[model samples]
Target: MVLRYVRRHFKPLLGIKGLWTFRHTPLAMYWAKLALKDMLVETVLKDENLPPDVTNAHWIAHVVSYAGYLAKIRYEGYDTNDDSKTHWVHFCKDLYRIGYCADNHLPIVPPLNVIQQKQEWREWIIKRVTGGYTMHALTQQLIAYDNDTQLRKGTEVEVLDKFSISRMRVGYVKEVIGHRVHVRYWDTDADDQDLSNSFWCHEQSDAINVVGWSKTVGHAISAPAGYDPAEIGNSSVIKKNPGVNIQVGMKLEAVDPLKLSAISAATVVKVLKHGYLMVHIDSAGHALTQTYRGVESDANHGNNRFCYHVTSPLIFPCGFCKENNIELQPPIEFKTDNFDWNEYFKATGAKPLPLKDLEKEVIDHGFTEGAKLEAVDVMEPNLICVATVKRVIGRLLRIGFDGWEDNYDQWADATSCDLFPIGWCQLMNYDLQPPHVENQEPGLKPVSPGVKRIKSKSGTASRSKRQSATSSSD
Candidate 1:
């Protein structure tokens, strides 16, 4: 029996890679067998006398044939683009071959393609889990940081670069399960409003990554339509960052100390790197920057100095609270009711990069699309993001944070400290951020340059197996 065979050989199947993807393998195989039966019945009817005694060869053939069929129908022809169609087919054949070997304990000789896809799928699944809110709070409080945030419903947010790639966009949280938040961006098209189909990206301190999940048959969400948001302003959350310097103004999502439960819109009022940042909660109607010290944790308990860092989940881009329809705590009633950011940060204020200046920088630096680099995270200034230059505007690079999907990208200035040489992190002895890569090495993260393509609104894109480009300092 299949069950007996599986139990006897369970150790081998467990030892094989991609065992989790096969968590639902039986269900998938069952459906494939249903299709096979139809084909078999048709064949028997045509022959009129073929015996129904099924053999092990028949089972193996069925697995290969069905895998091939799934390859064509399910995975969008498995990367059969242009002249590489034959290569793609052979790759799928090798995948099936490996799957067969993993199950049967046959001498497995995996091809470059099979060895490759297994690596990719493994990494992909890991990213999906870490980038979503499915983990427990204690677990999150422990990882120090990750790809996404612990975003909850009704939280207004301005996700400029944390979980999305853009100048800035205002959105409201519809729901949060584990690590994924179903957000409704008011500026998005009708297609983007649907929560179930949307690919949600999770944010840690400085960077984020996207994980795709189903809206149906899982812990998905459906936010109420026509729900009006209160206390959330409709004005543009785009404010000129006064300083792009070490002691400069950077947009950060800061927790409103007054409103501990809500995600208040805040920014770096003062930057004191190596240990401190003075944050001002603007949209939440708070006054002045609150000083925060990073890296100092209780020696005995391991509790960090600031509950969150500049890249902390507690803080977000300016205007996050309003964008998400969450109310900001109103500033004290009568004393200096009006606040002027431009005047406040006049000396060392932050400003968004101009179109022409950014373009010139891109050309000067040769920061072409798909170029790789080490980037400083604006939120977690101390850490280096193993990144790629996703898009090149005149002088700015639309940056991709991690993994192959292009969803968790951000916009950064060409001359900002945020972008650095590939080996800067190692040279400085700072810990490089964890990768969303498959079989990645510590220092070198090489990726095959995927052709520049438009990123989908839902954050879903073709994840054809890509070989990462390793990094080396000259």
Candidate 2:
């Protein structure tokens, strides 16, 4: 009703009495953002072709266009209405005029009744709904995002600041410029015509990249896969300290599991015997930003007890995130239940074991590239399959799953319990899952007998030593 009265009386004042000065007001700016966002969204029926990419592009274009107009208005000293708004260059000549309230006395208008307000809102919504969108639904969600965290490349984000067609899509940041983002998102939008299309997005006022207290949800930053992870398991020996062992612990760089980016500043905390360590990051969020003066918001706050192998790529030296220009997020203080890992290890017998002796065993076994073997599928522990050695790199054997794509292939460190010799599955009373080719003959012919001897010898000896060492440490 206030808006209605204002529009009625303010029409005359609006023409030469420009209102764009409200751009400086925080409330007005926020209001404008919502208004602009809502203006681009259309209510459609369930059957409507609401491809996320098209919708995203549409909304992005709207924001850019509006931003451009605002920029023009600020740069040029001109007031514009629907009519009589001359060329954009008019403002370039003069300073923009400012408008302010002159008196405390305001025009009194009849207020809207509660029922009338509801009716008006219902009508407004009905007007926005198209012909097909009136269909009913079972569940409706009204999720509120509290924070609009700054976005950077590698942020794990879901699209919904929702004017775009790609609303609810989950993806990682591929690139970003200013307020615009290039999201490599994935969604099951089968009906969407432009599912594969890349959409440029302008960040929303309430865009949330990370949550402060949601433990069940995913983190705001995504660990990058572009870098090769450290392979300590492939090596028989590693230094006691991180960064120094691989590269120096005090200044070593590592991937922040809470917010994965290129790298973050971290210090070694504790060296777990089984190829892992506890680390403390100075700041997980803004790890990418260069430190010119003061520390960040989350600096030196948590134990950040992430256990990483000596060769894990997640660890890195200071300034790694900044040097790479990767988007960083404040580390989430994940709330987990307290439990003693030592007791759990003793109970389950699943303690992490050192790989040094196992590496020597694999090397001594004479297992080389192109060697064939039978191996257990970690995803399906009950199944064993024919596998081929793709290469011998360091202390790990890169094995390709036979008859299966490389997606299921693996790099098995000598200490990994997953690998086995040919016919070992048959010997264990576990059925083997061979390749489904009718003409397939035995591929690991020589490996079968040799594998039996290696398994009974080095494999058994390594297991005994690993158990004994872990027990002694415990």
Candidate 3:
């Protein structure tokens, strides 16, 4: 019944009501269409040269055309009084203007009772009969948006300030500029066929890149495929240069398990271990396993974390989560190998080394071979200092220096830097110290694995301590 009523009214308006059908006056309707097109084209071209406000007129004209069409339907149907025609035309015009306010991020103001009364009549006649008109529904939405009083008081400047970073261009340090893109407002004088005031876009010339709080670098920054750091330079400190070991901790600020469709914080975690580096994330005990260098772990280990080749840190807030809604905190500190390392060693019942014996082993493996263990200890402190500085520099440059394959290769092959790591340095080269492998009879015995190992100190230890202290003091 509702659909029938809508179709009954709309059918008449489609050239069946008061006028002769299109068959009788096809030429008249055809010429009217041509004139309308010409008018809009001229307006759009002229708009290109005008100020943003003036340009908005061209956009507004098109909106007005739509509104006017809606008004015409009512006018043609309720020809009973001049008052109805005036009311609809005025209501549609007001609706078009209210939309302008929304596009400019301005608060909408409710229309007067007169406009509301006209809109009510249009809605009852149409939706009750036909399903609903999208344009009519949108107009009603604008009314509701304007009714939010507190939002009306807000300004574009406040929104921009909260979301954008104010920075001066690299070359211009004397005068600071707000690095933001300002959306334009609507123009009222424009024809109904024109666009809205908020259509023009101009990039800021004086400001540097606008660093949105929500923006993040993707993982596409990894070096190209088949990249070999060892091949690029003579970073081989020994016959076999192993890569440095590293552990990572990930901490998510707050997350919801139910809302996969909602906004939340998440972090990526990586870990270092012997035999293979272990990668997994623990956020509030919610774990995600990660893979290292394209290697997969057994299913018994848990879910293998997928690695997206990372050149720059991947920004997860946009793709998987809501923009500007997530904030990541510093990682929860933990030793990656401790839990896994001790378990392997304990299970194997391997002989544990005394601190003195460990020191002697380090001295034997270290450069200036055969040096006294005490002398090696003295040199270890200096090596620790160097590693600390390197980590600090890496962090400052937004570069991860934790012995990733690419990072090590870059450090080893660089030709410009004189202070590059020596072949024996653990920064670019892996430790040569061999682990105690459990020998098993292949025919009948199960294979026993050795314990995971890690470097207690790296070149970045001092720098990390200082950074940790500085952050804590803050």
**Model 1, 1-474: lDDT tens per residue?**
211222233322111111111211112122322322112100001121112442222111111122211211112112434332221111111223213333555432222343356556445433433432211223222222322345656565533222222122355656543233345554455345332222233332122212211111111112245433332122222112233332334544444433233333344544443223455544422332221121222212211112222323244444444455444432233124443334334634554211111112123544566545555433333334556666664454566755635433545545443554433333333345544545644543433443453322222232222322112110
lDDT of 3: 0.21
Query: 1 or 2, which is superior by TM-score?
Result: 2
The per-model lDDT (C-alpha) reads 0.33, 0.33, 0.21
TM-score of each: 0.22, 0.24, 0.16
Model 1 misplacement above 4 A: 1-363, 404-408, 438-474
Error of 3 at 181 (Å): 34
Please write out the lDDT profile of model 2 over residues 69-107, one tens digit for every residue: 121111111122323321111111111111101122222
The C-alpha local distance difference test score for the whole of candidate 1 amounts to: 0.33
Error of 3 at 162 (Å): 37
Q: Which stretches in model 2 have alpha-carbon errors above 4 Å?
A: 1-275, 278-362, 436-474
